[model samples]
Target: MEVPPSPTFPRALPSRSIPLAILSFLLVGVISLVILPHDFRLQEMFPSSCTNGAAASTSGQLADAATQPVVDLRVFLGVLTRPGMYERRAHLRLAYSLQPRPVRAVIDVRYVFCNLDKEEDRVLVAMEIIAHGDIVVLNCTENMDGGKTYECSPTSPTTTSARPTTDTYYRLAALADTLRDKPRDGLYHGFLNPCHQSRETQYMSGMGYIVSWDIAAWISAREELRHERGYEDSLFGWWMRKGGFKNVYGEEPRMYDYLDREMGEGVTCFRHELIADTVAVHKLKDRLKWARTLNFFNVTQGLKPSKMYDVDRLNSNMYHV
Candidate 1:
């Protein structure tokens, strides 16, 4: 059979219609920009599963935390623990680890560690785990790198006081506020690179960095995030600063090495801002040091500034677990 000829038009679009087509494309782009947000809010970053405490049926409080109103932030504190430091954990729980967090969705402090080599230690650790339900055994490494992955939970939480405004918290807020009021649309919607001049100037302090469960989830999901040069703080700071959450970092300074003794201030820090807005206190090893710290805060021994109580840490360091 013979083939039929088909009608054909010019290959190129008419020049007269070109301007209209371009205008339509530009219009669509503009409309899209106007409708979609620049970035997802920090509060809205977590998955629905994070808020669903069905996985925490054994925990009544956890279930409540899940059903509660939208949380501004949920902080998960990872306290490194090991075999014979059960007393330390007890001191912490009695001192301040058990305080209720204020104005937040959730605040859970977990005693994180790995499996023990000895059968006896393992047995003790297992008892601690079953008794507290606050223990997290990674079984992967003795290092805390794996713990960076934890972000949410329910029940007999790490149970620390509310989010202690560490330098990071203050910095996050300042950066956030700056981005919100910036003249430009913002580099990352709500982030402005405060350290654009020197990348070295930007970093988060790992000692006491408070982050939303959503942000934690995001960081944990990325498997490639690992330590280099064996400095977890430097790497963590770098990861967070460049996590696209903010261009610069903030320091919530209450995360002191020790309230007073660690900094050589010797009871002086108790009167400083570090005490008032305090969140996390690090470097307190041994039963004595922990006891002193607990006394210093509880004002069981010496004089405190706010008339809250008299706290002479040197004199009041008698209690222990």
Candidate 2:
């Protein structure tokens, strides 16, 4: 009778529909959060932790460098000959602390090189330098080994007789004290035992004295401060936990001077113009080398470069050569 009981009005809306819609909306929200470039929670909580950690690790590594000394000068020369060596390279570790609270900091060197010759020079070579920083943290560790170790008392009687029996405990203690008290601003410089020194010289016989040498110099440094006294919460400890080495600032003055002297008038004529054009190019190359080295470390150790800070741009305006 009247439209066949109008298809029984749906008794009730399906119960699952509302829940399903809510679930879909929640899933989309979660996905959006995950896909976003920045995570508010992460920025708020662990903003610079990644970078700081890396720096700390690098700081601690300084001791390792001392333990296993490398032929720095040789390495430097080798790297010079093989520019590829500079690619994905981790050369130095650094530790330091900033002012105010005197928190410790650490950083690692990845790639580093210096360009000595101006563009106008017959020779053009750019040295590349790179480094990785863990994180900034406290340091509170003793150099029990006295910063050196002897596998066993020298078997040779002469060696044993000559060896001072007096323990090095006092010396270690003194070093520890010094490291602890080092000021935040104080800079620590560490050079490769045999730093590689390569000269890429370009000579033009036609132009009587036109000669240029492409040179590079690289080194590492660290800084630490004694903020708190005890072992716990020690600035060095925090530095280690963070990773190590965050940033590096150094100049190989000798190398630069050497290049200038070597190049002489060859690089003088259009120095201003040459510098202006090459500064950016050199920086780009340096950054490229750094990024590559960092990527290598990340892949090998599942570690990443610091995130809390950035390197001050290479000052192209300030030309040395």
Candidate 3:
């Protein structure tokens, strides 16, 4: 047993083994550093792994980009939804006369509401006398179907083409011109004629009066939401109601609230204008004077008088006396 124990295997040399073990550990550490994708500094040593990680990151970035929301210009304009509170504070001007025989005169009025708080948008309006006196009402609702009821058999057509197709902007322009021409009939029977010297006079005149109304537009958050969620049945519908879609009445209340919040309480008027035959220089001059005076702020400077369809060349027939 003692002889056998003397032959026990000799242990490896500590110096050589220690060096070799240290070298093996260093090699593994270097290999891992080069192989790992997270090692940015060492990535150059393993281009494939680095490229894969970069590609993945790029794909993630692309996905995020694709999911980002887009901005809408219509929503920026309050008209996209119900009128905004800022619109109620609009400033309006009224100038009228009852002289020059035939009670001919002009009513010039102008105001800036909402959108114009920053910049102006030109508004070209056109209007035709619909009715007058007790029988006439400013049917601001161009499409008669709005407040009217249609009687039809169950199988009858549900729609009709009797309603007038009027452009709101052009109507405003026309109204502006009419207002510039004083002694014009009032568009609405109950409304006080801005041209009348007093409320009593306006009521008594029965002469009918002209009016000019316009609004500065701004992006409407409600409208934007409606467009986004028109088909959805959730939060968007709730916002649309708050924004004014459910109300059957006109936007007067909304406009009032908007103005009250922005302009503070003050006396305000909503007037209308009309268009005139520019061939009559004398009348045109007078009308222009009224327009300039009423619109002293030049709020209509940016309005486009003509649309794309109006590009046709004018002929002699277009001019009048």
Best by lDDT: 1
Question: Which tens-of-lDDT digit does each residue in 81-143 have in candidate 3?
Answer: 011212211211112111111111111111111121212221211111111000111212222
lDDT of 2: 0.18
Which candidate would rank higher by lDDT, 1 or 3? 1
Full-model lDDT, candidate 3: 0.18
Report, for every candidate in turn, its global Cα lDDT versus the true structure: 0.35, 0.18, 0.18
TM-score of each: 0.51, 0.16, 0.14
**Cα lDDT tens digits for candidate 1, 1-321:** 111232211122212211000000000000000001222222232112222222111133444655665533333334555555677666544443323234433444345444577788788877866665666554333432323222233211111111111111111222223223222210111111232334444333334433332334444455465323334444444544445433222333444445443455654322233344454455454555555555545434323456564445444546432
lDDT of 1: 0.35
Q: Which stretches of candidate 1 lie over 4 Å from their true place?
A: 1-58, 67-72, 97-101, 143-199, 213-218, 247-249, 259-274, 286-289, 299-321
Q: Which candidate is the best by TM-score?
A: 1
Could you give me the TM-score of model 2 versus the true structure? Answer: 0.16
